[model samples]
Target: MSLLDADAHTAHIFTGAWTRSGGGDAPVVSPSTGTVLGRTGIADADDVREAAARADKARHAWAAASFEERAAVLRRAGDLLQAHEAEITDWLRRESGAAAGMAGFQVHVAAEECFEAAALASQPHGEVLRTAKPRLSFSRQVPVGVVGVIAPFNVPLILGIRSVAPALAVGNAVILKPDPRTAVCGGAVLAEVFHRAGVPEGVFQVLPGGVAAGEALVADPHVRVISFTGSTAAGRRVGEAAARHLKRAHLELGGNSPLVVLDDADVEAAASIGAWGSFLHQGQICMTTGRHLVHASLADAYVERLAAKAEALVVGSTEEDGAALGPVIDAGQRDKIHRLVTAGVDAGAELRAGGTFEGLYYRPTVLDRVTPTTPPFAEEVFGPVAPVVRFSTLDELVELAGSTEYGLSLGVITTNPMRGLEIADRIPSGIVHINDQTVDDEAVAPFGGVGHSGTGSRFGGTRANLEAFTETQWVTMRADPARYPF
Candidate 1:
């Protein structure tokens, strides 16, 4: 059976029920083999409006549902996701070009997201407030009515589910807009999971389409909050649109994170950490180590070690020949990655290893002698390319790392843990890791970025989830009504 056909209904757009929407079917093409796997439904402006209206209508009853009922739904969804892990992982590997490990990670995180959201249902939802007036006063959390979630092609399931599960648990109906490139695993799979879990009709819908669908979702008055995860440019547009519509936008955007290797660090250990950060899942993650800053004393050795590590990685289609690194998402991304590598080499950076591709598979690349001004170093390449630069002093390293507009994740590697922590404190970013790689996420930890990276309220754990999906309303009760001065 086809992977998409195994567990998820990929034939139609999910608007509570499967419905043929505006743009019709779009072929799901595999990045690994360049073959059409299946077809998924697409939504357009009108379809988005229809889904939004339905979600708005469904919001009230869901909000009024008992916490136990909502938690039961979430728990069931989590259980279902785990029970069908093999099918989901296969779909992820085929559709998203994820290797076994990466695909497994997605399934794990996705299930954990649902489980965490289930726990949110029973958490405290209100706070009692002290008032000067003789009255019982408190603040309670309420759903934001309807949430519009826009997820990216890379890390599709995790990105979409992070928002979708939380919003639903908090009692808001959701309309998810998965990237057209990854609609099946990202959108349709979630639809199947929630549907089988007994989510109320109109409480959750998946609309897979391109720009028009996303724009329509943002403009729709019924969508009270927009949770967007993608490129910085696209996120800016979503944020602006949500602002114009006067709604909350939780944006988890792009990053050009730095991995700092101190002179005191072990060259081999540091290289291993950097390689994992830069090459994992083809380095398409938001927190991939885009820039590697090595102490001038260890720069040469570090570059050689990192290059060796990059060269050792086997790049191929996992289906044909099990490989460490699978193909990138598509040709466009492959070309973009090559272009950045070419630009870096053209600007005097030495290509230490891997500046080549076969089909959609781009090899793990390492560039040495890269300066702060190098093209790939300055931007988020979003590929398996590590650009290493030398920093003469700690201050120089801090300056080089902080020079970029993107501030998502930062990693400091050193033997002295306190020293690493001190260095990490010097850099301003949403997430900082001492003696660890930049690419990391936990459902229990609050995840987001700062500055251009995101609109940093945050997006995990109890408080952040509540803040992201719920609004606080103040209420008061009195034994007798009191009159104000007329």
Candidate 2:
């Protein structure tokens, strides 16, 4: 289908019944052209409650199914996604305004996650333990109850799958609340694939709406776990609500990740990788390297090389080939980025290159001499902006990097393996890249953060995902009851 096709925006399936809560419909728009593609049904409090209850009802049956049976269903879902990759990619590009390459990348990640989840479900369950007495003890990982997954707009499809597949692999029913803007392409698509994979009705449901639906879902008693990815403020709200019910809350929140470039680093390589990591997805990623801390001696050269590389990036719609950058997800995010960039300039930070804002398009920005007091350096600038800070010594650089409350991810650029290892150890982030930027997230790595960035982790491998959704239960079998009489 062409990018302009209006039919592409319609949701394929919506299993949960809607209520008359008078919630207004939400319009899904294309960031590239700022045009409304279609409208999604918005669920109010009543609708959200009903969906949670439905998922709760389905949980026991799904959990009781054999592991092989569940695996078969997930594998079929993977096949379905592979079959419709092109259609899904087009919808993602239109709904999220991501470049074609980025849209494709998300689809690829989702497929991999589905396959991984299936393989994990087929693995052996429980382990045997030996006790001091003649008793056999073992522990098994069992799924928690219904999981509430609230996903973000940027890379919605990929992030949603990261939470949903794991919850399903562990035999837990899921209540997914995707970002209102990209629900059709992200949440709706996943629901369809899971259904095609033969997931029983109500086993997994998508609740599409705004904050009202999300709040209701998190507050529901049936939901035993909550996994969220979004702003810090919203994450706090979710965390607080989950706490009321004492639910297991896993949040991957906002980040102002740092990229440290030591004097021994390869300036050319660092500049190239840094530019890509910061500008990719227009820097909408939570793990995007928004702050750059470079050695004072190499600061000037690093800035020059980074500016040149940033200039080379192509900015346009995803439909156009070779477009390296795309528009921000929406106008609100664009305005936030612009305000931070403007604040940096006013705070005496030098604009090394591109600082123009036109509509949803913000030029790849590079600001130098940014301090902790500056908005760009301190805040989560979720746009294509990279601010550079200078440090005189390795100790000072490490201190500066760890100063932030966010510890999501950090990047270190140094050719010396020993120095890279030493720097990685000092950083507080959950995942640190050596001689690379923070955007290098792989499916096999433990992806999460420390401190305010998030709680708990996701996506190390199949076992990691399974663990995230399950709790350990110990079972002791005493063949001779009289032997242990006290």
Candidate 3:
């Protein structure tokens, strides 16, 4: 079945159906070939208000629902997603410019998110507190009422579903605002999941809009929490707005995640993993390994090996899968990547491989001797550009990795796992991977960043989601009324 009618003009998902949100329409184009696959209407402020109001109105009933009832719906949604894997993955490729591997990973993991959330629904919510008085006191977790989920274009399915599944499992209604770049799969397919799974109308919705709509969602008093995934700048705005309204906001923002290579590490293995970490999905992922810190001893050989791996990658459109990389989200992103490349080169960095571009599909690029002060080193490239920096000492590796404004993730590769851990401990990051790449996430881990990268609110696990999506209530009981100071 069609996720949405191809000719449909609106991008809004209302309760159990697709509705015409009032706003200007825009054509959804593929960055790979500039093909207009579909069109979707932007949600105006009024539409956003209406959607949130609907979610708020139904919040109490969802919160009061039984755990088994909620779990069943979430499990059904996951099962449906798995059953329709081929259909959803295909749309992801065309609409999001994702390669087959990237698309499949997003969709499949998104389904698993729902299943994991179902498990979380049955876990203990709070703890009993010891009191001096002859009264029983304990805390109970209650739903936050309404959650606003704002997802980015890079990994739409996983990002959107990761937030939605947890919110629903905890019995809070959700309003999802997907990036216009991937609305069809991100917003519409998600709506179909809950609707077919028998989730109540108005409890879950998808509002297809841009900045105006997002502001509207955050401004509303009914939206108690906001979960956002995107750039650091945008995340700052979202966090500030949520704070101004006394609402909780979980931000999974930008990352210039670094991958380290020690002298003892396997240069070939590190090169292979680093190539994928830097170039997968054209390196738009927030956790993409944007910086490469190799010890001086291995730096020369590592760059050569890394460049060979990058050069071997096939660059083609969606029809091609043997090609490892795909286009960035759009031309603007492509231009931004090129500008960073130019800046790196001007700073005396050598372009070891791929600095060329054809449309939005910029080839996987490698930069050697990128200075610590350069944009590609200090900032996130968000493109398939890995800026390699040579570090002479362990202290220099720590200093270079810690210098960035972003502290989302880091990767350390060494023959000794303990050595990798010791170095990883020195870096400030939420995700520290040993002998691996930076881009990583699962349904049940605490997935957020530190410093400029996030608000320190983790997005997975029973405790994490409960903390993010629920309020704690201290309940007490006494056998009889006791006299107190008046």
Instruction: Report the Cα RMSD per candidate.
Output: 1.5, 2.6, 1.3
Q: Write the per-residue lDDT of candidate 1 for residues 1-486, one digit (tens) a residue.
A: 222352245547988777787788788889988889888888989999988999999989999999999999999999888888888888888899889888889989999999999999999999999999999999999999999999999989899999999999999999999998888889888998998898999999999999999999999999999999999999999999999999999999999999999999999999999999999999999999999999999999999999999999999885654689998998889899999999999999999999999989999999999997789988889999999999988889889999999999999999999999888888989999999999998889999999899988468899999999999999999999999899
TM-score of each: 0.98, 0.94, 0.98
**Model 1: how far residue 159 lies from native, Å:** 0.7
Cα misplacement distance, residue 48 of candidate 2 (Å): 1.8
List runs of model 1 lying over 4 Å from the truth. Answer: 1-8
lDDT of 2 at 408: 89
lDDT of 2 by residue, 25-69 (tens): 677788888788787767678876777788888989999999888
Order of candidates by TM-score, top first?
Answer: 1, 3, 2
Worst 10 residues of 1 by lDDT: 1-10
Candidate with more favorable, higher TM-score: 2 or 3: 3
Question: What TM-score would candidate 2 get against the native?
Answer: 0.94
Q: With candidate 3 superimposed using the best TM-score fit, by how many Å does residue 485's alpha carbon deviate from the native?
A: 5.7
lDDT of 2: 0.82
Model 3 Cα lDDT, one tens digit per residue, 1-486: 755555542544455467777876678888777888878768889888888888888888888999999999999999999988888898888888889988899888998999999998898988899999999999999888999999999899999999999999989999999988888888888888788898998999888788999999999988999999989999899989998999888999999999999989899999998998999989989999999999999999999999998898898786456767777888889999999999999989999999999987899999999888777998788999989999999998899999988889889999899989998888999898999999998887888889899977468877788888889999999999989899
